[model samples]
Target: MAVVGPTGSGKSDLAVALALQLDGEVVNADAMQFYRGMDIGTAKITPAERRGVPHHLLDTLDVTEEASVSDFQREARAAIADIHGRGKRAILVGGSGLYVRAALDVLEFPGTDPDIRRRLEAQLADAGLAPLRTRLEAADPVSAARLGDARRVVRALEVFELTGRPFSSFMPAREYFQPAVQIGLEVDRQLLKDRLARRVHGMVANGLQDEVQRLDAAGLREGKTAARALGYSQFLKVLDGEWDADQATEDTIVATRKFARRQLTWFRADPRITWLDWQDPDLVAKSVGLCR
Candidate 1:
């Protein structure tokens, strides 16, 4: 089953608990959580928090390595099959909407063409997102309608340019997984914003800046996707002297809020999802009922 929520929605905590109770294994869907040495900033589940339950697809890659949504889908699907083979449920979790949808929809990405990649990279560098959105709109207005995300739009355009087909066309046009419940954690907007601010502040207190320093010292650059992770990138500005510490923190909070909104939009589109308010006292029971 799938679990999705905003950054500070305690997805990891709920996932761990559900896995333990259901005799299941957790699969990581959050993009940043896949990278090793990104523990604190990614808010990765600690060994203790895992409560001896198995979790897959987290910390299995180096920070410098690229993790495409396609790669995640393959790995997550394999994990789920293995869990089913072992007679245990696979608790798919985290807030990366694309990864979650990929696994749940059993998506098949088109093969990449190097020539297309080069051209798309050039377009990204020169004309920027506006032209990419225009291109996606022209190729597949349906897919464009489904995505307001600039990043997804660009990626779709890249796929189209390479294959002469809409990226959405690559998705399996029929059901894959037969039946699995989807649960989404939710919070009031003001409450979630407050929680996100506090989480950002906590990350700063927990050496998020020092983590950025370590990553930078280890040769991660602005162009790399890992370096572009929310708090990490903003802290890079602080290190570069482009922003003061306070400004850096403020920027992270604002960006996080925006990211959380996007996550909400993505999760809300799935009719299978059962929303659980964070404040619900019966959350465990409700979540368990979903699984049953």
Candidate 2:
């Protein structure tokens, strides 16, 4: 089973509750939660919050390392296998749409060529996203339309070069690798925005700035992916004197709201997910029934 929704929608809490009641373990799919010492910024559930439930993949990476979706696919599947081997159901939970699909869907990742990747990366550095974006548009307009980041654009271009196919051709269909259920938590849009703003303020009060400082000292800026995470990136600016704490907090709130909307768009595109009200009184029972 997988629990998915936008951040600040209580997906983690719901996952933990369902796991506790369903005799299951949790497999994290959130990309940023993989980094250690990113607790405050990532809203990582504490041990107490986990309520003695075993959680796999949280805090598994250092801040300096980039997270690879392919690597996550392998590891998360292995973890699921291990959970089933122990006669326990695996509860996959997170808001990262692609990571969730990569873990549960019949998705195949194309092989990479170091030389091709290097050439693309060089072109990106020299000319910015315009050249690569233009190339991707000509080669794979579908992928080009969806991907805006330089790293993803380079990867898409590399895939096209290596496979002679559009990167979007490899997009996951509505098929699961294993029999599973997906539960989506839904929230009121305006209320969620307000909650997200409050959540960002809470993070700041909970010492997100200090967490970023520590991670920065540990080389967070060296990790392209980790450095650019929503709250961490904004707080890094605060530390760099680019923005004040209040500015960073507000920027984080806005970015998080945007991210939440994107997450909702991505998850809602999947027809397999069963949407449920986040405040449902029978949420646990309903989720368990869906799993059954």
lDDT of 2 at 226: 97
Counting clashing residue pairs in each candidate, in order, gives: 0, 0
RMSD of each: 2.6, 1.3
The C-alpha TM-scores of every prediction are: 0.89, 0.96
Could you give candidate 1's per-residue lDDT for residues 208-233 as a string of tens digits? 88988888887657335688788888
Error of 2 at 11 (Å): 0.9
- Model 1 TM-score is 0.89
In order, what lDDT does every prediction score?
A: 0.83, 0.93
Q: For model 2, give the 10-residue run with minimal summed lDDT.
A: 120-129
Report the error of model 2 at residue 290, Å: 1.3
| Candidate 1 Cα outliers beyond 4 Å, as residue runs | 123-138, 141-158, 171-176
- Model 2 residue 51 distance off true place after TM-score fit, in angstroms: 0.6
Worst 10 residues of 1 by lDDT: 171-180
